[model samples]
Target: MKFKTSLIALSIAAAITPSLVTAEESDIEVITVTSSRMDKPVSAIPNTVTIIDREQLEQQFRTTKDLSTIIGNLAPSFSPSRQKMSNTGETLRGRPPLIMIDGVPQSNPLRSGGRSGQTIDPAMIERIEIIHGANAMHGLGAQGGIINYITKKATGDNEHQVSFDVTMPNNLESDGISFGTSYSFSGESDQLDMIGSVSYRNNGVYYDANDQMIGVDTTQGESMDSQSADFFIKLGHNFDESRLELMVNHYNMENNGDYMAVTGDKENDIPTGAIKQEQPWEAANNQVTTTSLTYTHEDIAGQQLHLQFFNQNFEAVYGGGCWSDFYDPSMEGNDQVTVCGTGDNGESLYYEQSRNKSVKWGMKASMIANNIAESGINLAYGIDMFRDTTEQDMVVSGASWVPESTYENIAPFAQLDYDLIENLTLSGGVRYEYAKLKVNDYKTMYGYGDKEIQGGSPDFNETLFNIGASYQINPSIRLYTSFNQGFGMPDIGRVLRDGDSFPDENPSIDDSLALTPIVTDNIEFGADYQGEYFTAKIAFYRSSTDYGSRMVEKEDGSGSFVVKREKSVIDGLESNITAYIGDYDDVGVNIAIQNGEYDSNDDQSVDTDLDGANISPNRINLFWTHNFDNDISTRVQANFFMDKNFKDASDEVYSSFDGYTTVDASVAIPVYSGTLSVGIQNLLNEDYYTYYSQTVGKDTRYFKGMGRTATIGFTMPF
Candidate 1:
């Protein structure tokens, strides 16, 4: 499937690239990036990286109102959006990337609750940096790559801004309407600069392609029916040859949907629907607060030194008892227990709720030394130390689902960039990581037989390395090759909950029952070409692992599963091209072709292919934008997905996702004091199920993409 899609996409690129003529040569703005710990020009970085500036973010948000979807459309290797709050299967380079907010980790590595993608509000973001592929610069959870959301910074002398926006469905439907407002203030003096902003948003119910109420996903949370708010502030003071900065941010969101899901008929391609229900509890809730302090000294003893300390607190509450089914054995003889208490007789009953809470604190220190031994070599060395504590429990029953676990990690790394020759550079890095985990003994939930699970402490120490080289063929082109190692641990909570224990049994933790970490070796080769009016890049990479963790279905077909470690291999090619046509029109195309396989039988042959749930299918995205002289711009975008069969076909009634295409359009114009934006998502209104919905057999999981919904909003600034 990927081969066929690649051919077609390449053909389209060949046809479009030559038609757009180049404009006069002009100096393109150079973007500075901090993904590698050392600041460098994006063009000089020997990896696939993308930067989404504030302007682009605002424009994209007008169309999708989702951060993950915007990134998926702009980045070639990223999977298509799931159209939901949880980004469970949205992998990059066939693996999940570590998400960060202002260099502070947001991902829950120990449990992977899948809510990290939306930890921060897009309204408060200044820009986003995406580093693709594996590297050792950031220790742990970089198997695929990293995405950092850079918060807004103070600009200009003294600025104060206020904005408000409101949007509703084009058809005048009462559902799916939204309203938002924000206020920002910034000031700069000779020594100090500061920026602060606050925002609030309220979202209404969602409707699908058929203009019908969409089903509620109590487990993962739905963005369409939520209320969110955010507050951010940053202060920076510049001293002679040194700088000090402090930042604080708080975000909160909660689902307010008053409906519940009703199963649909999958054989006929019918999606689940929602029905009014007597409220039991809020669907989902999330809150996050972060604080950080950073100090940098330039030319300290002929070297640059930087230090950062950060802390974060997070809590998430999920709706109902979605995790498992519960019944009172003592009440089995009474019909009232089955009918009245369980809501089987049409009477509403309060639903059980679950919550996850975590706290994380970390510090990092690094130094950059130049001209080592007068050999035209630059070196960056850093040490990172962090600790995280996480726990999950039932809100009503006070039963522990996952016991409080504490993880501490300390890593030190060094990287060198050598100017081996004029126009040629070599880079290498190595890191030593020491991680320790501690968990106390606890009793399992009543639904899990109330077993006493003994906890254990584990420690790991490993050394990882990376090497790369880049050759500047000319001012317009460059070639590069790299090899890197990445490491990550399995979801420990998943492993512990799958133990073979009952109410009458107690098991002790041992090495045999402990989860092991996974290590991946990645290799890539790529080329970049930049012209006065056009830019293009192509990269081919291969990643292999001896023992990688994956969730697989159990043989009993009870909707329960366990995590297994197996040999796996993933290889892919990604390409992107953008052309500026006469400065008024811009066209771009992105293609991603990838495949993954694992050794399911343990024969080490890697015979079983991975599914869309694990690996993204071949995808192509194209966009064209036109700008008018009157401060107006319009953009049209299209996305296509290729059909691919699943590796595990037994559980799926429909084993493959039928390919589909979608198009969206948006226009922006300067209004009163700010901007007015109008967009029509799914312009064609093609009623199609998402890849995930098509493959999953469960009726309640089937969801169709949104319809041709028109949105118009104006932001007024004062």
Candidate 2:
């Protein structure tokens, strides 16, 4: 399956590239409000873009188990599950991408576990805009790409709407269940109009044909649940022939889940008394809460102002008898170690509770103006400021081991977009950021050392810039090129610990080390066309960097224990085509392909050429949608991912996961002036894995995706 997926990806790329060269122009124009903070047509922009409408989102969510699956199916090889299964972490175009809600940044690089950004209820989303390639105009740190989530706003009509859903499966009838409902009310009696919505969702773990737990542990009988609420209010007044408006929005989410991990071995009177490294169990719990508020005004002097604030709290705890409070030096290397004179997997013998906290705040304001009275030129500028702080502490009941340390960053930037020629657009932007870090005074574990290690305030100041231009070859086609810079600073927790190296019996030397920032220079070229029958886009990018992040190996050179800095380069290509086949029926099809690779890497240090390396090389997404009549319609989609290569040189072993394709079909039927949807996902009952990783000398699996799911939902209009 993996090999076939890869081949199909290559074939799709080969086909889309040529189609881009021959794409023609279309007359339909869709207005966008993100790039310029004002309404503008997509064709007027200088970049490749993809928009996911509300209908598409509803169709996917109704059939899939979670949003993670939606992301993986749409973009080949892009998996959120990879964060837990793979140690190296997942990146787009060889680097971490940026995520934004409305116009606010949600990425906190200093947060533990690297889980940034908040999840939104799909029913509240109006549309999603995806911008491929480096985003210099959006400010620094956007090396790979950007995703902007634009949610639904308020309406003035005095009406309410609600939606609800329930799911079914091809196999286990008792194990599958899900339901959510949303309500919206609007009125126009006073100067203010408002809309409020609340949603709740819950789902049990899914099992595959093999009767395996998939990603969950049957021992825990775990499940996931989430609750969200959103509200928007718009107040406006008419003065003479002009009007002024004010818009405010607020969103909140609370989620909780249990996580599963593989422990070594479990046996009565186990040697080392520490469970063997291959036993699987559900031992951790995660809870997160996020809140955001925004205020904005539009149509004011070709200028707009936006202010946003966000706060998120996350907590993770190891549960059960496995999480005890005790440290016995005698348990170092012995199999039959004692924890308070009793045998308990290293927990009671040597364990400590860990907790992490993070806070982030940022705001941006931008303006756009045209030289209507000057040289017929257009200009755009914006300034932004952001700050983030994090702290982690290890606690055992009432006692503390690792002290709490904090890291913070302050950044401010400005950008300009100008029309240098009649048919060309030029842009330049720069950001200067300063980071401050401090480690609170603390004592070493086990009284191993007396003197506390104080992290000297390490500060970093960086300047990032980019230049780009777009040329209008004609009304049907446009060419664009850009050169930009990207950077990422060393994280707070890893900044102090250098991993195991240089000694086993040193009490005076500080084990923590400070690292430097990694930067990259990226160049890109792309073209877009809107023809009579089809719309196509193709882009190529190259990234060269002096410093890169990779896993570091121990002295024995058998495995990895640390993340080291290296130098490398990456290049890739992306292309897609959308065709309108019929006018009477309004039928259309869309296809996309993406390829990427690392030109140079230092995986040999960890004993593998493929470790810490993954490129889609090829991906194919196909969608067919038709409007059968005014009130009814149907759609079908197929997503395929190529097989990826995983090799560990030290172990002298190579493994590859076969790729598979997922087929989805859906239909909308109008009942009593309401919309009813029915859909089937994974229609072929194809069992495929989304991630693969090694644990304790053997390979383990997280999920096999979903076999087959059927959903029925209804949206009512009062």
Candidate 3:
């Protein structure tokens, strides 16, 4: 591990040193980020943020459709990619970040089923904005900040335009051939503009470097042997001083693999594989539909006003039942009986499928005023309200895993931007939130003896604040600092499902089962240097919480888990440097280092450092790109992960992950009013294991990463 770390460090050092020449004038376009209520230039913002434009996305993320993998590569603070459909252990700075599409939240905060990261297809995204560290602007679920995906918009004066794109694997293997196609039409008139697109993709089976079938994890919604479709439409009309816009997006994805997992021998370095099997009762499915309406008034009594209303419907289903234990009344003393597929009558029963459904609606209204009272102050205030109902159940048995529950939240926030001096600016915000949850009485499932559980109504209220300042010392140098607060509620469903005694049997339900919210305080300091040929950024941040939420595995082998709260602290450093050598070539390097600790014994003392489950290992990314004169471009990239020991070494259930590096390359060429691209993923064919597969103790989850695969794609416009 130590030798591998040193090798990676040397490689990164060699790649950056040669291009660290003197700065010169360059023609870099300015990027605007919408992290705040208003769109501000990235150079002027005090927070650490990264913006990936359409060009970058098309060039860098053409080979893979995983959003987590794409974002993790570009952002330093973000954890390494899971390379799967589910983002179970992916975190930003040791905590989960809020995901949004067009300013509408997509994360299921109530249950957090680990499917939020895959809510939308990469083909539908126009740009992605990521804000690092804790923030209060977005209210709940922003404990580690926000990642907002902006959809495409109509452009140009053309009355009508069409575009088509197709991509497929170049490998000859029939089972490894994946294909996707998309068609889009956009038009703009004097007063109206509209854009719409429909896309469908069919994925083939996945194999490792050894040409062995990858293991199927029904619980994680594996993408292999799956099909997905996306539909999107947006329309906007302009008035003299007001504008109205509407958007609708639908996405459906499901896994229909014909194979089941076969556990491996981890001690012997053997990976889990798949074998042919009969189809289960239900395959893993993820579907979502969203609709939104937005209205904006440019000049309303010298204040700009914006109003938006949105609704979303979502459902996700997992694989069939594995194994569980239940109390059997047929026994003399009601002894617990373990069952895999047989019922009380010793007859075979269909495997039970677990699923969750959610319906959410929300509204937001905000107004911005400039030069308030001639005090050189810009003020922005907003009100947000949302209602969400979610439920979890077993389809085959009609049993409840999580009872139907409704969550209502209302928040009011205000932000101030003050021009402190000629080159310095000060910004601050405050927000107050009120939330309520209501649940009805329900009976536990077979696993819990089918006991009736009492329901309750709970309310939570909190106030959060943030402040920051940025100073432009020179034309090419800027310094910034910020202190922000963010909060998150516990997964109530997890708490309720672990109920051991009913309210009647344990009268102190409120005190014994009620979970508390977690509040985080983050402090960050950073500096940026932008020049014609060289650009660099460095940031350091620390976040602490009196109570933090985490998932703990169950000892009963049911593959179920519960959420718990404890004291936690996390701190990290991020740095990135990019140098452009002339007009055709560029080199870049990014590094991230993080550490986390928690009070495991609840003695007010931090007793253990966090493992891969909570914190990501140190990582470094390096890349170089060159553009030829004939409209051809090529890029080579590498990512390195450093070795680390798991925090819970005393627990035999934990495993330590070994460090490894991977390489990738791609080429793009322009042809006949279109672009043709060829890419090789896992160019080195490292034959390594994923972070989750390496660190997980169980054999069922042990699997190797994807092998080297070639892809070819083309896009044309008419």
Candidate 4:
């Protein structure tokens, strides 16, 4: 591959030219370990790493643009874009992880069934790295670990840029807008380089916490709107010295309000009486598309190389028609009768329509080798491939409910790394997977008879593994450990099931969607510190599973949504810190913590004890950033989310999520040259709710988490 991209551009210009001429004369590269495979430097990489720089996302963007809590200020009750029911559901250490951009593999396991919730739009991020555990060279779907997004590239400087943001709120007379523009060019001696960008966002309407108007399934009056458009392009070249690149990205989102599910009880006549649709107030719509290609090469003789390719496609269409499934006092005023009629009975209904589509493609290759003689040894290697597909159609045409399904998958991987000495490091990895599924009924193909006589065709295969170690006790300390094995498969809408004789023959119904495939075994340990004024990390974990996807009890206590492959276990701990309290170079502070449990037992029958499953065992974060002397600046952030006394493996019942603490603060100054800021979010006024059994069932009260919110902005870099 162009001689390993000229030996990784001569080993990253010989290890970054004396650390870029001593980074302002000392310290400024505390940690970074691109999930191992020899990018080594998170204290030699034994696991557990998180780096989100760019001045903490521009000081947390002042107040809120809902970066889904931006890692809960720094790990604590994370809600990576919470729209619940997977409107980009995200979690790490506490489950659901694996997200990458620059290295490809941008999760979309055929739509939310492959485990990693997908949603990208963090203003084309420039930095964000997390490794945690179980890498398996980022293949076969990482089991709760990995989130790498490093964008914004193209630098040869021939610039032109622009950015804009508008937000106003204080009792809803609303306003929210975003705009962007960019352009770049280079050719001093024809090393070639190019860049492009465009953006637009409307994003308005969100108010909850008794201020009302943030409804969807709870129907407390209504509102929620979103619109988006984004585009990007980049190209780079520099032969001989080695360097090649290409990129393209596109995004589109359109969401209107009011569309909720889980309907079942309206005095239950068997129509929609168990509905769990939260936030439903009345309108619906969704879309995404992306593309990418990258290549890197430098210092061939000493080794270093990288290549990546990517593709993404997404589509969503929800039914609209002022939908309401129930509320008929025997035609007390009849509005065309409406009597819909179906299963979870809110008086039985049909034809609410549905559409879902997803596609992903990726490829990756890397190699790094430096100073291999004198036994100082250093090496790195990697390989990966992916393909995912999903298509679901639940159109009832004239009212028949549920039909159409298809899912497919393909995966491949490889990895190896050996530092041997100098801080000590060793690693290994592997992965392989193939899958296929199909279902068609078209109402039994034409005659509208035989609709579904047990449709068939389900196939899957899998394999994955990993191993690791790291040690270093000098130059500021380091320690590491690892053990891994992960797997996942199942998502064609979880293999659509639930049908048993309505107008014809039945064979004792209950197919239970024949599910299986979800295995994990993770064990990790960590520590890395670089003191001169703090830079820390801590990790401890245990994950066990024999198969996942639960909720299946029915002997009366009610529950049906099967996928109980049995066995479940999770134990955890995570920590983070970034200090530098004095010396005025710009004071700083950051913190993080997480806890976990779900120690076995969950045979569906709900639950009665052994709680701690709804995640978030404990979390607390604190932040402070200051720099005032000419270009004034200030920031203060805090977060605390605790609880998860959760239980109900099937009817054991126990739920919890009460612990709460929120605080936010911000300030920035630098006019003319651009930059003006303000902040105040969730400063007390705490009234909460976020309990789910798949979309808000027992408690669906929300308040937009915008309690004391206030923001103002401006930016420039010419």
Candidate 5:
């Protein structure tokens, strides 16, 4: 009864439920030792951790295949889904997180493509691990935390599945119809194991509650009116004292909609819309391929050894623009006509688009040693090295927007765990990072006057530390605290490409504002209680930095995004609890509340509150899952976003956002030969603007969330 808080039960909503961390076993033990950076029980780790296992993933899959939606509902701190391919406004802990796939980094930190969250399909994933807080354990770009998607593993028994799914809005319009199919297999023979999967999905056009066409996000890319495919393969072999594994994955998505955006009037509350029309440029697209090889050896001179090598290749093309000073030439069935928006033959409105391409390669090695000479102590150490080359260019104009930049980094880290008392463990770790970025001279595109900027080589050296202690109060409860530091670099590409920012007097990257490396310090206190019929976890955290980059819209009215570095602080509380209602039913509630502000004018005072693009709104969620006779199961979830207002304490722009609530439900039944599934998203058909569109207050980007939707799926195991 350590978690008896009856007074708050009336306001209870569930972000953590049976759909999130459902363990078949009742004993509290190590869930998984893969993504913690160290092999230990979560109770021994001093930081708050969130683990989503396959059962949870499967439950979400029955509703929708959107990765962001699945994560947003499972984790309280995650931002609401933009319902798009680009993760522009998706921030974790009011900051960007380093996303990885089975130990391979997928985030393009050098350039902001905003496609890191969609690198892999959920069908190929077995579980997800999220380490909440600022830390350098992953070596770079983990300002908020680390999210690792662990791939499925091959079991001793050979098994396979084939599935087909379809989703659409409640109206059942043809344009709202979407479909997908996938096949996966796991096989093992003696010491060899293998797993493979291929999946494809074509998303239909989206619609709001009013049955109006949702505006397309041509600038950052969109999930509506798009088609995507994913393929993955993994192989492993076990030897007497060593093991080896290889993994490869390829994914691509492209929009082929013949439509144009219709800007709206936010003041009058007219949401953005879309119409059928010929587009001026190539459709937006994204493609990614990753490869990794890993080796492990046990009892290597009394230490466990592990090594990994990985490579990632990525490319994306954005939608064409129709703004002033941008030349428009590629109109379908028309010559290179520049007449765009009130311009005649003589007056040309310059319209252009860009593409992002990057390649990353890296290697990591770590070793673990325990109880040296029979002492009650343990240690783990590792080293990581990586190099990335990235560039952006106008797809049609053949002009470089951002010069090719190569980043090289090498970091070594070590962690020690010591038992200070019978029930208390002290842990400490430190990492040193050495990085160099080399950029060549390049010219900015139209709008900034096509200015030529000189590029220089910038290098950084940083030492980061993390220390924590966990004390077990009893068999069912534990308390912990931690202090950690994280190192991050803003995408210099944004600064280099901004022709308007470079003055006529200066032309070098060395003196560029907002180009400094960001180092954040974070502290947290947490407690966890695990019982047979009740479970609860809660954490309070605060992070601050004298200088750090925050994402913001460009003030030049180009409808582009940029980064601003200033003093900022963020503090929040996250908690979750689950109570078994009976033998086959469970109900739960969870809440996420955070506040963030920054020194907008660089005066060193955090006076202005952060916008929705940087921080998620406070949320309360309720969820319940029940099992019935004949192995049938059902789940229902409801999430509410609390309204918020920003106080103008500084010179930055301010706006208020109204909140809304949405519900989702799903059920599974055993059919003749397979499982039949059905789900309803936004079951109440609530109509509302997204957090970003409401808070940013830009007419062109003001958009509404999705309306009610229904999906059906069937799974056949062979």
Candidate 6:
């Protein structure tokens, strides 16, 4: 019975949305046996798990390589893309998830720069696995969930592939054109396997529906007028009882600053526009390099042992503007009036940019013992250790925006799984974390009143646990429930950089509100049903945290300021249904319904509904796919976001978020021994602002969605 249910996932290989899973717990082959850090069946995963296989991923890649867009369309609970380089406001289940690649962390939770998603090109990835609720399985920073990108391996037969894709707006103008090219190869010889790939993309200027130039998001990052490249390689050797693999990945995205953003009138529905310029914005870039070596032994005293060591280097640059907080770095006394000289009207001009830089290295060692004591019980135990050094520095001024900070963490965990009976399974795990952060005292920024700020080492000790149960309700249905806890750190850099957060005279080192760690606990239950022609799933979850972080835009509009607030509660439901017509045709619908609120008055009671900044409105996606006799396949999907309106604790209405809709379609046909694919974005040319732009209501960042566009690609495998 379970084996039949597992066939659903293998059969619906091209499901575009977050769809059904393969319940191959013990009957069918383990579908998720690679790159999962922990070797286990998909059923062992407690919460909802969405697997985006290569087929669906390539189908999405036909339209756009922007991972955020792909995720928004595929993942049910993922927030809408901000349509910028930064992933800010792109929370999962109302909280930031831990983003990783090949079991290596890519997210910088300490500073929270929101650039994790773009660390690697999607072309190098073979699949994506998302765990829907908070958990400590991956160690730190899973307050929301986990998004792990599994890279392609070199274990297949000798193969080589090359592909090129080009995209342009409906007008077919040269300015709004983009192109990408990639070459990849994999070969297996004897005991050795090797794989490598290189890819490059160039994006031209972007235009809105009105045929106006879209403003460049210099502040975060932008895809417009940018160049991105990726290089990846992995080598592995198989031993009689062990396997060793070494991998390296280098990625870079640099924005070409060729225009200046001109603010618009939000009240009048005018979008921010851009004008051509040759200014120097070389500072706008994201560079990441990661390397890891893994060794696994299957015969270690009748147990499996996995060991890995990894290192990552990251740097990100944000646009600089002459704000009141910026000071001339050449001056010794923090003179504020230097970079952008006074204008004719005695107003400040734009000046310097800032960069977030960090280096991280970590190691993990784990052992799994099956059939412990012949009781049909399994135990998986491991220890994780990592260190990260992070800081934010001024790009042009060569000054420090946030002082150098170092963090160290060591954790040990144990997980147990047992089939209590033939029809019931129980799983539990525990992890203990010991962490420390060190920062030296430094003078505050000019906006911080030039006072000497005190910095000290802050340490933490925490323990998190998760438990789950699953019961087979006959052959075609399975029920699961879980309680999971996660731990994370606030965006310490936000408060530390703001001088206003500290008081004068004997300012104590303790600022619990902004510096405390955040802990979240989630309770979830769901059911899965697999039938001959119908597959469906539904999950409900409630998550809460005593101390959570929230961001509020400043009055001057320089940017947003972060604060640690009271209790926050998030409740949501995710469900999807798909009907199949034979093997090559299917129709599906997925919906995510969520609402979040927090205690605004600090009175120990929830009072305010979270705004768009922290939560996403309800969303739905509908799609259909068909394959004809001529080996031609076509897929179409439409996404809709419902309107959202909420108020603060004070009863002031904020963020009257109007809903919007977009449609996309793609087709692939066999041509000359290769596949020729074409994709259309905004097929109906529905003009609208992004959810972020519509909710924020800021003129400078009031960005409109992209206009109608088309993409063409050709792929050949040899």
Q: Which prediction has the highest TM-score against the true structure?
A: 5
lDDT by residue for model 1 (1-718), tens: 0123553455344211111113333333256777779876665667777788887787787776678788877875777777777777778888878888888888887777777876777878898888787665666687888888999988856887876666665455776787778888999988789999998988876676678777777767777778899999999999989999999999998888677777877888778777877446657888999888999999888999989999989898877643233333333454332232443443333346678888999998999998888998999998999898988876755556778888899999998999899989899999898998888887665455556777778788889988889898998778988898887877776666554422224575445333677788889887766777666777788888888888766776456556778888998887777777776997878888888888878888687777666788788889998999998999898988778876642434236778888888999999867888888888887778877777653687787777777777667545
The residue-by-residue lDDT of candidate 4 on 1-718, one tens digit each, is 0123443332222100001011121443445555565566545555666666666777776676445466546544344244322433345554555676666665655345322333455666666766654455666456666767777766666665555666544464553222223333332337667766666656555443444333343222121355666676667777886777787766655554423433433222112111223223223334566677767787767778877778777655554322332222233334433344434434433233345666777677777776567455555655566666565543333332334444455556555557676767777666676655555543332212333545555667777777778877776657778887766643334334333222346421123334445667788876655556554555567766555543333343322233344555556656554455564332222333343334245443322332332243355565667787787778776665555455453544354555566777778888887777776666554544332322233223232333344566666657
Q: Write the per-residue lDDT of candidate 5 for residues 1-718, one digit (tens) a residue.
A: 3445662442242222122234333434546546666667666779878888887788889888988888788886888888888887787778888899988998887887788887888889999888888888887788888888999888756989999999988678998899999999999998789999999999999888888888888878888988999999999999999999999999999887577889999999999889887677788889999899999998899998889999999998888776654543334224444344544454456456789999999998999898767766788899999999999987756677778989899999998888878899999999999998888777776554577778888888999999999999987778899999988888877877777657757677666766678899989988776667767777889989888887676766656667777889999888888877668888878788888998967779898898887888898887899999788999999988999887557444468889999999999998987899999999999999998789864888889999998999999988
Model 6, position 706, has a per-residue lDDT of 87
Candidate with maximal lDDT:
5
Error of 3 at 598 (Å): 1.2
Model 4, TM vs. native: 0.32
Worst 10 residues of 1 by lDDT: 14-23
Candidate 2, residues 1-718: lDDT per residue as tens digits? 0123443343345322322122323323544647434344565555555566666677676575354455544443243233121122445565665666665554545533444433355565676666555554444356556666676656667788888877665765554455666776656655654555556555544544444434532121123322345454444554443444443444443323343434322122111111113222223334444445555554466555454555554544332223233343434555543233333453344333444455656555555555635765555555665565555544333233334444455556555566777888776667676665555555444422233454355666778877778888888768888777776654435433332321345421233332456566778777776666665666677766666554444554323234556555566666655565765232222333333323233552333433423333245667776776576877787776556554454444455545667788888888997989898877777765544322112222233455677788898879
Q: Relative to the true structure, how large is the alpha-carbon lDDT of every model?
A: 0.76, 0.51, 0.76, 0.51, 0.82, 0.81
CA displacement after TM-score superposition, residue 659 of candidate 5 (Å): 0.8
lDDT of 6 by residue, 272-327 (tens): 88888755545478999989999999979899999999999999988766565665
Better lDDT candidate (4, 5): 5
Against the hidden true structure, what lDDT does model 2 obtain?
Answer: 0.51
Positional deviation of 375 in candidate 1, in angstroms? Answer: 1.9
**Models, CA RMSD each:** 4.4, 7.0, 4.7, 23.6, 2.9, 3.8
Model 6's alpha-carbon lDDT is 0.81
- The TM-scores of all predictions, comma-separated, are 0.92, 0.78, 0.92, 0.32, 0.95, 0.94
Tens-place lDDT per residue, model 3, 393-421, is 76655567888888889999999989889
